[model samples]
Target chain A: MERIPILRMGDFLLVTIQVDMHDELAMTLQDDLSDRISKTSARGVLIDISALDMVDSFIGRMIGTISGLSRIMDAQTVVVGMQPAVAITLVELGLTLPGVITALNVERGMSLLRERVQSE
Target chain B: MNVLRSGTQAVRIEQDVVLARQTARKLAVEAGLRLVDQTKLVTAASELARNTVVYGRGGDMDWEILEEERRKGLRLTFRDQGPGIADMKLAMTDGWTSGGGLGLGLTGAKRLVDDFSVESAPGQGTRVMICKWT
Candidate 1:
């Protein structure tokens, strides 16, 4: 059982995805994030996917689900560092992930998450 | 019977579909496709590969590297011998799904590749082919 480490930075949680994601691993991340969010009572989550070069329909849906779950748990999730290629693919797959927020990079995403959390 | 031939990457399990995406990406990059094209092809491959394993109950995907006078292309064909799709028109429709999914795999894969084709029957198997040129 492989695990993706979730790092805590201040009141925010940071996750950097580096593997070629499979269905089980993606689901594991969702479960791990949900538990971490409730346990730490984190205000925001910043997911950096710069190392992930590919995203499929399943992964796209998983992302949307994660963000929606985080919102219910009172945490704002901001995904950042999406490559141009991955963006194009997501659109083509008709998965805009309307429920999730995105930013250009980790710095911007962290700021955005903070702003959203503060506003909430 | 779904058999793996030489050079054919068989995607019979969930993990195989993940490997399929990796193989597609590597081939797309080796074909000199741009970053966006490579990503699109890889994504499409993932969707189709998952379909083969999930809906079709297991299948194999074959990779072909093509070089024409003008461009080089990578083509992938996914085949399955399980209960085949009965309605091509309905299956290709966006938001229409026989299985539990976003219902975007068939239609979305078509949009991402340069060439796409599907063949299936109610009792026969399904074969989907897609190619991207650079």
Candidate 2:
């Protein structure tokens, strides 16, 4: 199994998640990311899901949970590069994420974060 | 007239998802649905099958092929005797999840198919009916 990688980009953190994104791994990633955000005091987070081929209910919920927790930790989150098919499937499953903003690509997501940091 | 096909197999809750995906793929091919349509059916079935094993304590999936004139579709019913959901509305919320999921399973599954219905009660288990047209 490939472990999720977290990298630092200026004040923001970029977490690259590549997996099937199902039950236990999803939950663990959420908890771990939330904890890291608090500890590192990152201003923003970019979650890269471009490599994920499959996502189930549990994984969807975990992503929502992470977004919620990131807010509490005073960090903004951007979901980057979601596959079109995956996005459609998630929408059909009624998993619309309210607070988390999704970007068409990682560059756009990073740019959004830069704007956020500059405004603050 | 209804063309009924039944499959029962002993499988772990984790593996049930695989079975669901396989069944959906087979049905989609047999029905000659487009690749996009096939993917939608597979994704919906994946969510429901995960629910059967994870939340419903494992169960069975029954698929029925329906044809009317030039139209063809497939209906999948998932029956499980697990602890039922007490609150349907809350469970439908995007961020509301008992487990660590993104809580999109039920809602996402609903979006993939043309018709969807879910029935559940506390201590009574759950039944989910979904259909997709080619």
Candidate 3:
């Protein structure tokens, strides 16, 4: 099975989704991120989705689920690099992604994650 | 209206859903739709294709590029022989899903397209058709 790699970066976990993920792949990612958060004792999670052109209901739901899971697991999650087209489509699809944090790019996302983690 | 190209792709598993999105993107581009419009159509296709797999048990996505009176468009129809929707009215309602989804698949897809229609019965399978013109 294909898996999206989760990179350990100091106190944070970084996931850069570059492929057009299928449904199962998206679900697997949710599971893997949760496990990594617990094992690494990571303080934050940063997901880069610039490469993805679309965010359907499934992927949208997955993102929200990941955010919620990481939070209860004692980690903050920040999603970054959403394409403009994807943002437009996501809202039109009726997914506002409530309760999720977002940043413009990885650098900003990392800083935001750092700020949130430190302030907590 | 005239069909410039037409084809059918299976939606049996998770991967097929990706293919359906790719196919819709291609057709939308070929139809000369704007970037945002193309994204909307492809997103709608992704939603419907997934419903066909998860709810409809497996199905097919039929695509056609159309031209009429100087306007170009892309049309997609998702069909499945699996157990059909029992209450289409409730099924089409926003935030209502039988499959643990966000219930946006049907309602959201309908919002993303210019034209949309669905036909289904208890044992008669389901067919959802949507069109976008540019």
* Candidate topping lDDT: 3
Q: Model 1, B29: alpha-carbon shift in Å? A: 2.0
Q: Give the per-residue lDDT of model 2 (tens digit) for B4-108.
A: 454554324675576677767788778777767777788888888887888888888888777867778888888888899999999876656787555667877
Candidate 1: misplaced stretches above 4 Å?
A: B1-6
Evaluated against the true structure, the overall lDDT of model 3 is 0.94
For each candidate, give its TM-score against the true structure.
Answer: 0.95, 0.73, 0.98
Estimate, for each residue in B45-95, the C-alpha lDDT of model 3 and write its tens digit.
999999999988999999999999999999999999989999988998999
Q: Candidate 3, B117: how far from true, in Å? A: 0.6
Interface RMSD of 1: 0.8
For A82-115, candidate 3 gives per-residue lDDT tens digits of: 9999899899899999999999999999999999
Q: Second chain TM-score per prediction?
A: 0.94, 0.91, 0.98
* Global fold similarity of model 3 (TM-score): 0.98
Error of 2 at B15 (Å): 5.3
lDDT of 1 by residue, B1-134 (tens): 12222268989999998899988888888878998999999999999999999999999999888888778888899999988999999999998988878999999999999999999998799999998988
Candidate 3 deviant stretches above 4 angstroms = none
**Model 3, B26: alpha-carbon shift in Å?**
1.1
lDDT of each: 0.90, 0.77, 0.94
Clashing pairs in 3: none
Instruction: Determine the C-alpha RMSD for candidate 2 after optimal superposition of all C-alphas.
Output: 4.2
Q: What is the lDDT of residue A14 in candidate 3?
A: 96
Interface RMSD of 2: 2.8
- Order the numbered candidates by DockQ, best leading: 3, 1, 2
lDDT: the better of candidates 1 and 3: 3
